[model samples]
Target chain A: MMEFINFYLIPGLVLGSIYALGAIGITLTFSILRFANFAHGETMLLGVYITYSLVQFSGVHPLIALPFGALLTVIVVLGIDRAFYKPFRNSPTIMVVIASFGMMLMVRSMVQFIWGVQLKGMTQGIQRPMIFFDSLRISPKHITIIGAAIVLMLAVHYLLSRTKIGKAMRAMSDSPELAKLTGIDTEKVVRMTWIVGGALATAAGVFLAIDTHIDTNMGFKMLLPMFAAAILGGIGRPFGAVAGGLVIGIVEEISSYPWIGVEPLLNPGYKAGVAFAIMIGMLLWRPSGLFKGKVF
Target chain B: MSNSELQTVLELDQIIGGYGDTQILHGVSMRVDPGEIVVIIGPNGAGKSTAMKAVFGLLNLSGGKVRLNGEDITNMPPDQVVHHGVCYVPQTSNIFPSLTVEENLEMGAFVRTDDFRPRLQELYDIFPPLAEKRRQAAGTLSGGQRQMVAMAKAMMLEPQILLLDEPTAGLSPKYRGEIFAIVKTVNATGTPILMVEQNAKQALKIANRGYVLVDGKNKFEGSGHDLLEDAEVAEMFLGGGAPP
Candidate 1:
């Protein structure tokens, strides 16, 4: 039990926090923009690389360098949106979706060109876990990641519930035509979507980097699970995305736990299949997801 | 009264427009004077709603002008038109279904920079039922209640004029009567209303003046009582009977 708690559960939660953060952006973009943004994973990768460079240059913690990375990422995303997405605003949703897929490849290539395809570590060395009650081991970085994620989630909640622009964002997601009739500026709302989505993606990338080494393919690798999290939570439901992310992350880790004897129940090698299975099951049984989000 | 006070608040002059080369409004013209309830009643595809859309700049006009307070606002987008003190509640999908009723109203005042709490309270007073369901999602409400939410949302901006497209489209007669009464109460508050209504008789009963549009042209324009009394209008459009 101690080993399961320490090695599987704790790691699952840290990974879940990162997935939750990334899934927020995916869900927001999917719901508000009316397209599944394929470039979202690359957006996360771009932020990670930017934060990696900042940490290398300034010798600051990734968290400390995160805001700068987020700001830069937002700028780049806004530029990309204007160039690629804006023209397809009135076109069929598939057009923007294909554009994003193309953008994914383009951004990945750009990252490879600039940063090179090599793994880079955000921190120098892994620190030992702080043992509690002689058996419970919780790493300091895990605490920081979970704590920061909670703070950010709370902030997102406040923004969506309390602020004017945030309410407008919800309004747009609910009904774009009504939002326009109500005098909500569509472009402004889109810009705010990118800002919030970009910042959260940056935070997600930074958190993941702190947990594991940063690689060019890191974001792409996590993309499927994050998407599974978003769909499981509900397409446009942010809080649902958080729950979905935690569930997916925990399930992926626990699927390999030696629940039956000690042979590793499902073999850790097949962990990614768990997300795929959940996603397929969800699409088949509850396409609207757990929160009754928009279908399709 | 001063000349400016008598000036038309909203006017559509020879407005000609439609969707994708289909000209729905062929030289449609109308106006709403201050504090008046102007009803535009016509059969299906008669350009009643299209005229309203043209006024709100939801569609482009090939010829003619939309004037708010005598300022030409032709082809202005819907968002910009709201800033010009015109709020339009579309016929369907008018409320943010997933948002709470209060949030819907808050989004209604999205363009307003000043404090809108007092205005919100004022709207709540007018629409008492909405106040009760302020926290409930608008979509979960009954058809009548959702219509109320839609109208109340448009009222949040305290606009110079309110444009309602079929406010009582799918409500029961009881709710329809309630909505008509609510329209009168809103007009009593001095905001001119220009609405397109399917319930022509009831609408004209509440309207100060009304227009009878046929095939995108104004067939008859008179005081609501006069139009109701007109034998030709009664036979063709008002279900043919003695004036009730």
Candidate 2:
């Protein structure tokens, strides 16, 4: 049982960390911009591709490429804002959601066109699993992904609590017009939000690529889980996203095991089905998710 | 308040504005002169707040012009209006609730490139309680203190004319007096104030000029004392009282 737990549950947790990171970005963007960005998954994919290209061409270490990838994602998302989102900002929320869906399609096709439909394995050679006790084990790749996530989450917490920009973001989330009246440059705050959100999502994408092979479809697959985690945690609660991700990870993994002899009777293809079942159950039980983040 | 010394500071001439198809302010005209206090008092739906919104460019002015010191400012965005030496404090959530008192003030001077220490100290001297609670979150402050922060923030630009939308709403009588007293001090510094207030008597008492609005139009306009003494205004507007 312990060995099985080490092999699956631990890896699920590592994957959950990535999902949490992505979900935090999603929730932040949703709160500030007031829309679910379906295109966010592409931001993560772009991060992996950019880092992969950097490692291939620039001879930069994958570890060093993390920040570079995040920065690139920030620039791209900011560019998207300049090109698209900011223009239709005053339009209805549904319109913005449609636009983001359009953005998602555009970004996905662009990635496919450029990178081709191929899986590219990471060449950084940080994949050796480190044994922890008898049954628990961790790898350098997992350590990097988990460590980076902790650092970024802490940094985000401090930034939101201690910095002027963070306060402005929260204020805007609470009441945008009031924030403007108080002299917060709403544009600057929005830009800062995009930067932080894009950076985190990009980092998660690169970390996931480190754990698994890189492909354009990778982010697409994780998109549902990330969204589920974010919604389960609450729409705008940052800390809730992290916790929601872990809970989702554990639930998905534990449920995929043999359910009273059913797993022995059925093939392992039921794992993804079980994950979605848990997600649906969560949605039915709590519509606002656990934290019930901001309404406006 | 004679017209000779009262140089025109703000003017909204035949202004029409609203949110989308619903017209809120219908040809509302008003003015404020430098170093003067102009109060607009009326019933709940009298468009007093809408008039303030028109001046601050919060609403689309469907018709007419808004001018500040002779420059046409009709339909200018709020940020630009702030740059034109006019600051507007909204009625509710006027201050950034999540920010510290000092940070809220800092945002007030966001457009300023110069060092704002003198202005900060000036506001500190103006509101001593705020000075003590500089590090406190604006949300954590009492309603009156939040109103103070909002007013102090607008004053950071040292605006030539300030527009306040119901500064005394939802405050205790004691806090209302404190807010009105602060308004007097703010005006004493030579910034003309045009306020739409629910407390008609109290507002008119402090006003050099008063406009009693009824059904989106000015019903009466005169010196504060004149309005206070008018039988119609006394009964209908003030609900019968000497000026507070």
Candidate 3:
């Protein structure tokens, strides 16, 4: 029993951390842009591709590739905002959502055409496990994923609370028109939000690639679970996303076990189904999410 | 007012403007000299706010020009108007709700590259209640406090002129007095002020000059006391529920 607990629970915790990080980016983008970005998954995939290239050609350590991946994603997101999002600044919300879909399809096709549809593992090669207790081990990949999530979350907290631009972003999120009259440069703050959100999603994608295999459609596959975490946590609540991710991750992993089911034929592959189930439950009970404040 | 001593801070000359396709201000002309308090009062839909918005570059002026000190800024955007030393405090939804009072003030000085700590201190000193609640979120404050923050934030740039659109709208009678008192204090400190208010009777009491607007035209213009005491002006625009 203890062996099972250590193996599944600990692994779920690590996976949850990555989902939380990705959801934070999604929620942040949603708040600032006032629309759901269906294209965020592609942005994450772009990060993974960048990290993969670094590891393939330069022989950079997978851990070192994390920050590089974040930086690259920031550039990509900012460029996309300048080219795509800024043009529709005053357009309707439905128009922007459609534009985001267009962006998603464009990025997805680009990734498939460039990288091809194949699962690629880390080139640097992951090491064996580092033991934590008797019959319990913690891998370096898990440590990196968990550690980076903590550090990045803390960094984001500090930036929002301490920095001037960060405060401006929060103010804009609360009330955009008011932010403008108060002399907050709405344009600059919007740019910074996209940059920061893209960076975090990129970091999460790289971490995810290290833990599993990298593929062009990996972000697309993670979308349902990522959104489930965001909505379940509360649409624009950051800390709620973190907490929701862990809950979803643990529930998905635990329910996938055949022993828990009435019908023993059910496989662990049903984990995806579990995310939808949890999401439906959340929607039925609380439409505004678990922590109700502001969704848009 | 002396010709040389009358330092014009903001000049809107025969300006014609509206939202789109509809003209609200038909040849509206107004001015504010340095250290003077000018008030524009009228019934609802008299184009008073529209005229102020044209000066702030918020509306598309179809004709005439807006100038600061002597330079033409007829077609400039609202954001650029701030750089030209024109600060406008809108009637509603003016301060960021979720931000702290201090943070909102910081954003008010967004265009400033130099340190604004001294300016912030000065503002806090000017608004002592805000000083005690500097860290509190602006949304959490009372309606009066929010108005105070909005006014103080606009004042952060220390612009040569301040434009206010119905600063005392929807406030309690007590808050109306408080807002007027603050406006007087703000104007006494060298910045010229041009305000539109629904509270005409009270507004003219503090105003140096008053303009009575009716149906997008300047119906009456004179010293505040003269307009206040004019029975014809009072019967026409003040409170009879009919246009004379």
Candidate 4:
């Protein structure tokens, strides 16, 4: 049982937490802005690179530099919104989506130009998991990932439920024209959406880099799982994304788990296919996801 | 309620504007003085709604101007127009469907820095149905209830002049009378109104003055009684043949 917990459940929980963070951003951007942001993966990768650069220059631990990188990512995301997305606010949603695809390529190339194609790491030494019981162990990095995710999620919930800007955001997301008629500055709402989404993306990136490794392709690889999580949670529901991400993460991780008693059920290489299957299955059963979230 | 000292709260001086590349209003002009109700009545497709949109700054005037208390507000973005003490309630989608009735009310006060609790209480007292459904989503409300929410939301700003584009567009006779009563009560509180309506008879009954717009130009302008009483105006607009 300890071995099972350590091997499958714990790792799945950590991976799930990262995807939860990313899916929250995707769900938020999708809910308010009404488009599938194809560049979301690239945004996360950009945050990781930003973290790597910040740690080198500021001489701080990766965790300490995480927020600084996230803050910088906010600036980058806001700039992207203003330059690429805002102009298409009145245009068809598909237009903005195509623009985001362009943004994906542009941001990917910029990351390559700055950080190069080499795989980057914040620490050189291998960190060992501290053993608890017989064959049961947990890593400090995983603890940090789990802890940070809970903190951010709570903060997000508070913001959405308690604050004035939060209510304004909900109002805008509900009916943009009515929000305008009520004199809520819509441009400001758009900016706030990006800020929230960008911050969450940064958190996901930092945690993922801490857990595994960082590269330009890490975000791209995580994209399928993150999107599956968002869709599974219901595309517009932030909390739903959380549940969706965890389920998808566990399912994906377990799909690759080597059988302890019998032959392997599936190849480990087919891990991504697990996310796809869940997404497709959910789409068929409940297109609105577990939350019945708004598609428009 | 118009005192001799009443100043025009809002005015459209021969405003000419429309949505992108399509001209709707052709030199439309009107005004709402302090504490008075001015109603615009016309046939469908006569630019009655367009005139309201032009005055509300939703349309960019290619020619002419819109003035609020003598401050030129031509072509201002609709969001900023509220700052000029003017609030507009569109004909459709006036309420945020997903927002609670109370949240909709709070949104109405988005521009105000002062506390809005007193104003909210006053509105709730006037529209008791809203107070009952304060926490309910506006989308789930009945048509009449939703209209009340919309009007109440717009009134939260305490606007000096309201541009209402058909407050009674779709409602039962009972709800229609209820809405008109509320409109009259709101206007009696020193907030003047400029409303466009399809129910000409009921609207002109309470209107201090009325304008008949035909093809986006002022065809007839008079007191509500005069417009309602005019044989020629009645024949042309009220679906009657020329008087003998």
Q: Which candidate is the best by TM-score?
A: 1
User: What ranges in model 2 sit over 4 Å off?
Assistant: A1-5, A124-126, A132-136, A254-292, B4-6, B21-26, B121-125, B128-137, B240-244
- Give the alpha carbon lDDT tens digit for every residue of A1-296 in model 3: 65456666777888788788888887777777787888988899988888788888788887787688778878988999999999998898888889999999999899889888888997446679887667677787788789888998898888888898888887777777666655668899998888877888888788888888888888887788888888888876777788888888877766644466454333677888877887888888886678763644
Query: Which residue pairs come into collision in candidate 4?
Result: none
Could you list the iRMS of every candidate? Answer: 0.8, 2.2, 1.7, 1.1
Of 1 and 2, the candidate ahead on TM-score is: 1
lDDT of 2 by residue, B1-244 (tens): 4453236889888988788998888788888887899999988898999999888888898799998888899999887888888899988778877568998887788777798889999999999999999999788999999999999999999898899999999999999999999999999998999999989888888999889888878789998878888888888877775445
Per lDDT, the best of the predicted structures is 1
DockQ of each: 0.85, 0.42, 0.50, 0.65
lDDT of 4 at A192: 85
User: What is candidate 4's TM-score against the reference?
Assistant: 0.91
Cα TM-score per model: 0.97, 0.88, 0.92, 0.91
Q: If the candidates were sorted by their DockQ against the true structure, best first, what order would they fall in?
A: 1, 4, 3, 2
Cα error of candidate 1 at position B167, Å: 0.8
Residue B71 Cα positional deviation in candidate 4, in Å, after optimal superposition:
1.9
Instruction: Classify candidate 4 by CAPRI docking class.
Output: medium
Tens digit of per-residue lDDT, candidate 3, span B216-241: 98888988888888888787766643
* Ten contiguous residues with the weakest lDDT in model 2 chain B: B1-10
* Candidate 4 backbone clash number: 0
Residues A85-117, candidate 1: write the lDDT tens digits.
999999999999999999999999999999999
Model 4 achieves a DockQ score of 0.65
Which candidate do you rate higher for TM-score, 1 or 3?
Answer: 1
